[model samples]
Target: MPAYQLYVYEDQEKREALEQKICEQVDACTEVNGKIRNRVKKFLIEEGITDISEMNAALRVRYEGYLERNETVHVPITCLRGFDRIFLHRMKEELKTLAGQRKYTTEYRDQWLCLTHYPDVEVAESFLTSKDGKELVWNFTLECPRKLKMQIFTVLKEVIHTYEGWTRKEKLLALQRLYQFCVVNQVSDIETMTLEEEQKFALKLSEDLGEKKKNAVFGILRMSRKILFLQAPEINWNANVWFLERFHFSKERINPSKPVELVSFKEVTNLENQKILQKYLRYLFGITDLCISTIRIKLLELRTFLVYFNGEEKPIYEVEAEKIQRYLESIQRQDTREKTANGRIFMILQFYNFLVVKRYLKKIPFRYEYYLQKEVHVHNDRSVPEGVYTEILSKLAEFPEHLRLMFLHLWCTGIRGSEVCTLTGDGYEEKDGDYWLKVYQVKMKTYKRIPIPEALYKLVQVYKKKYQIGPEEYLFQNQTGGAFRYGTFRYQMLKYCEKYQIANGEYIFKSHDYRHNLATLYYDSGISLQAVRDYLGHEYEEMTRQYVDYMPKKLEKASEAYFQEETHSFAAELMKGEFHG
Candidate 1:
């Protein structure tokens, strides 16, 4: 590998000296065995080094004997996987030639009759077995290259290693179809392949499979596309080579990015304010690195402040700290939570900072700490009264069993709605005679195995049997098995809100209220607050404290744990017991 790098090394005269020594071998040697140059090339061939740039620092010491006293050293570009940037161009060229595009089009349609049919041609087969054929095989792979001829075959190996789902048989068939698809169709780089070409190939595979063979060939083709998407950027071509006009892969695997809207501030009606607002938002998006969702949320908050100051800034750069304070006071009139008010305050302060940095404002605005609302204790209350919890459960029972299990899974495990949507039918597990609910907590990016009560376990079992759902399908899919996104707690509450409402839908408790109910009740039943914190996946005990309520000291006086038995009443069930639900 080191010797091959020396071929392209910038010091042309010195690299030529090393190349000549390797080519001439013993004849170019000053020493008896000519071991240095001979051994370098021999080591590369023996080690099966295809990408010579993998020549590491330690290996460079082997060439130390040949180094001139003050020569500058170069950095190695190869990654640990032996992926060399230098090999990219040559690999594409070699693959294009091996796929025999010019020969295939010229000969398969016109020239070498003996070899045009490929592998079956006897005289061609004889030539392939000769010395030139031997070189062809060696150049392609360390493996038996005749069978796996294209560069894409090596790429397929990488895909199989990373694909965690498939079995050995499925992968082997995928490989067979991939190699045949590449060579016969003359595809060198699959990432640049068009949608029409992919569809045509998929149709051909379906015809060949017939009724006798199972048609899983499409999976292999998609696998090839995924592999191309992942590896194409590693080469020096167009960085967006993998992007296509079509999206053929799984939406779950790759969530399609929301389309970016083109905003025109001209609709603001005030010309000066529109121009300033446009430039400010454009500057915010361009300068700061934030995800689109976070930026959009911040931008909306900024818009509220802008609307409040609508005609105040005639030239769009005027400021008054008293007016900004009045805006904050108006927001508090809506009974906004302290956290939400703080978020708006945060955005306003940042917008002022941007204006100051741009020199548009000489000096302006109130400091964030001065206008802040006094702490709203009501937002900290996360628990419902025991009677309300019982009512919610009874109302849920009136819904279908699957819908009921959705609430049961969230309430029992204390996982969020986003995590619940991803739960599979096989998420239930038993170990050491105890059932565990597998919870994938998306926010914390961790998994939790919350112990399940028999009531909840039985409820899930009934749901599976009644619905005839497979263990692998999504937990919350529709009756026909289409997935509904877990957008918000509104997905759970809206339908029942009117029935539960004391007035308008404003007073309805959210699905997350069940999380708070469990956290508080668990602690009330003599469970430690630290345990509740861990179960809730809170970053700090302080956040968990916000979720749990203050339990009366007298509630801790019980000799036996109230949660030991699953009940049918207020605080009826906790995480323990074996009663059939």
Candidate 2:
């Protein structure tokens, strides 16, 4: 058999009365029919009672009546004392409305009693204890102790007297006057007052305190206290003082007789030794305030000078070269592992050559030969073979809409992922009757444009509509609707591939693969190498040839057809015999 159910909407005070009525109705073995049933049903109907879903008498009688003969029904009751009756009534009405709207029947049962949804508990308590529920409780109960009755009478009298004594505007003026009087009397510390004193003070202040004056007084007091703390002698010992000290400068003596000269590094041996020395000093001192690229460039220059000093025709002695090597080795060993020791050494060697060949430094060192030989081993690892382009493209097709668009943009255009990430609406332009996305290559500091595809254009239109893409908003915002981070995008791509079971092949599908794919596809389609280079926005044709060589079948065919030995020999013979001089 299905479970018994009951449904009722009653305010807190009425809840107990209703429950008692239900119990009496059940105990009396009342036969609900004809005139009696009609009277009860009419009362229920007038009270807007509909289906007995939560508590159904008929269902309860059929299923749990036998249990009722041996047991008692228990329903927990919580008295919402001092709560607003009108609010509770409205809450009941809302629940009923919801029940009616959903067409709930006798099959389900649920109950709730909500007081208020105010965020602050204190405010909710204050509103609950206000005059709103007083009359509703009074109507149902008259028996009370004389003291309670007298308390109620006094409260009502005070409220009525206050209301009748002054208009709202006059009360506001009185509040301002009272607040001013309190301020003059130095009684602003409300905490010092007893509860009764506070009540009296509040009543008096309510009549005279102006909202603006109260706010101004509070603001002035708060600011004055803050300023006093700020001006204290101990403020110099605060954390902020140390932070500001970072920017402070000690007085330096100026050489008034000799003016400082501005000269290019190129003019001074085509190298800035002082800048290199500063970078080395910063690195040694663990200072990271300098730009990474600037530090790298300076390090490279220092290495070049060291290499030149060591690798001159008149080589530096073994002792001197060992000293230089030890200094560099010490830096390498200091709290950091070198990922590419060979690369570091190669840079050092290159810098040495620049110093020597540029006539900035002199001598080849015999001890440096061992380091050079050791560096060659680091370069022996074979480069990974390019992964299948088709596999990457297929996987990219299944990417989420936004990422798919990004991949498509990358694939069609040979632009780097970083460049694509920084692409904005401002980069798009109508160039020679074609819509193109302009990208500035950060590494190269060069600008180029890629034509937009029809599909991509449509996708962007929908994206703009959904995101309400403003003129200044990033095209690809993250989940929280902010610009996508490069690290986040890369992490997402890896996770996506892993979930989809894409093979981790020789070449991982990095952002640069898109450039490779674009170049390979265009080259294989019989486009001229020079034209392909121009399309991919490569500054040099030699770089484009790298992609051309990757497509060995196409390269072999072009070599056989255009540069055959027979063709070359015939052309040479014809040139030798052709002139009718």
Candidate 3:
């Protein structure tokens, strides 16, 4: 490492002394005119870039006026574009500022940042002066050919090692291997490649390699740009949803099933739209604690809108209401569900609101505010009938202990499908004589404790005692004593349904429907609306009532007066003709 001195400036005398050192190096070279050389020299002097030294590896220069005293590094040459071709880069302001002067090209970048794929030295020399715009220059060196990969591997490895994940080192090595495969297959410029071509290449690679190896390839290829974004200050991080999965499987850490769709800022195409989206996304990620699953949804919304209008390649903020209406109509044709199509319109309204608030648009250009409410009426089919629950529970008694405990817990607690698997022993706590089940709702990102009634509370106590569960152990673990898995839960439910000849039509009763059953039972037991909301972790009163909204008008009033004292007999209230005909 080169030693650095701050050159703490006190007065003009010290500054002049530092300026003379740079002048001496310029004075040594006699190829240029004094006036022309001084003109270039004046820009450097005004910019405070005079500090220069000839290191063993390369000549070093640090400008003044910069806080760090080490920014604005320039070429070793007396002039900007002179031969000896000392890679001049790191423009102070915008690329347009330099482009207007004709002093800099559009491709201006630091020599260290550029990784050329071309093997010819002549072509490489042409790229230093930027004469040959033909040479493919990857921002990440690992994407370059063998020699360049060897040069960058160590630096990139050190950077990758700084990330929090255990797979950081493996990701780096895998990226290198993938890059080499790309290079060998003549994929010199991925950014310029058409989407179809890229997909074909991926397909070819998958066919050549086995499925396992192809998946490994996708993992590395998908992560390649994200790793570069973390390391490179020049290249920015764009949160583009690859496929934007229809659902988030919490087991997969909410990541999409596939991440290699070649979706990026390149999809936006319009430079202004790219800038607005970049700013918006950066602001959102910085301010919001939204889960990765939610973030992907937002990213996909932006991507879909952008791609919809990409044919014209106009800036997205320039959109009019007619275009929005047309887009909505188009989406209606594509999506079969009215609710799904209307949800797209709802998101677009919010997106328009974002643009106006962020000052990306002059005013709200969309006239679809009145159409925002899409009458998305959902049927009250997400619950098992009282007769159905009685049959299921009686049949469940014959199953294994783990299977019985899982269903009974969800039934009594009204917990979501995945939440049942994630419950910890510490989640169960005694307050006075009452035991509370601590629930951490992943979607709402909040925690609440629901009081355990006598029968279920006793069951939890007996279950914990029988398993010899510690405070940190899972409240409901598997037979192997590990956390319960959703896949295993579904499998067990399917087998139970098959053996008992139970089915809710073609669909077996889902774990979520048990939550519906709990909500109905609570309302029937005259539990307060506020209490139901608190137990379910719902933020709004309206959401809490959604469970009971489907009941008959008479039943709604009747249920409030009805309370089963035994708690376990709450289902019997539902079995009466008021709930089941």
Among the numbered candidates, top lDDT falls to 3
Q: Each model's C-alpha lDDT?
A: 0.53, 0.44, 0.56
My TM-score estimates for the predictions, one after another, are 0.42, 0.38, 0.55
What does candidate 3's lDDT look like per residue over 137-188, in tens digits?
A: 2344234444334333433444343542335434544555555556656554
Q: Per-residue alpha-carbon lDDT of model 2 for 340-453, expressed as tens digits?
A: 554555556654554465465666442444443232212121212345445656777677877776766776676766555655556665556677777655444467766877
Clashes of 3: 1
Tens digits of per-residue lDDT, candidate 1, 1-581, equal 59767776756766556555444532332332343334445544444443343343233333333232324423111111111111222233333665534423311121112111232233223322222111111122223334234335444346434433335335545556656665576655554444455666777776887633535656665555555555443531221122222323223222112322222232343445555665676665556544444555666676666666666646546646666678877766776777777777778778778778888887656667866777654435666566665666767766655556777776777777656667778889877889988766544545788888878887778777876768877767744564435543355456664565523445465667768888888887889989999888888977787777664333454314554444533254433333445
Clashes of each: 1, 24, 1
Best by TM-score: 3
Which portions of model 3 miss their true places by more than 4 Å? Answer: 1-177, 184-198, 206-217, 223-278, 289-292, 319-321, 331-343, 374-378, 386-404, 454-507, 528-531, 553-581
Which of the predicted structures, 1 or 2, would earn the higher lDDT when compared with the native?
Answer: 1
Q: What lDDT does candidate 1 reach at residue 54?
A: 38
Off by over 4 Å in 2: 1-319, 322-398, 430-433, 478-483, 503-507, 549-553, 561-581
The alpha-carbon lDDT assigned to residue 70 of candidate 3 equals: 27
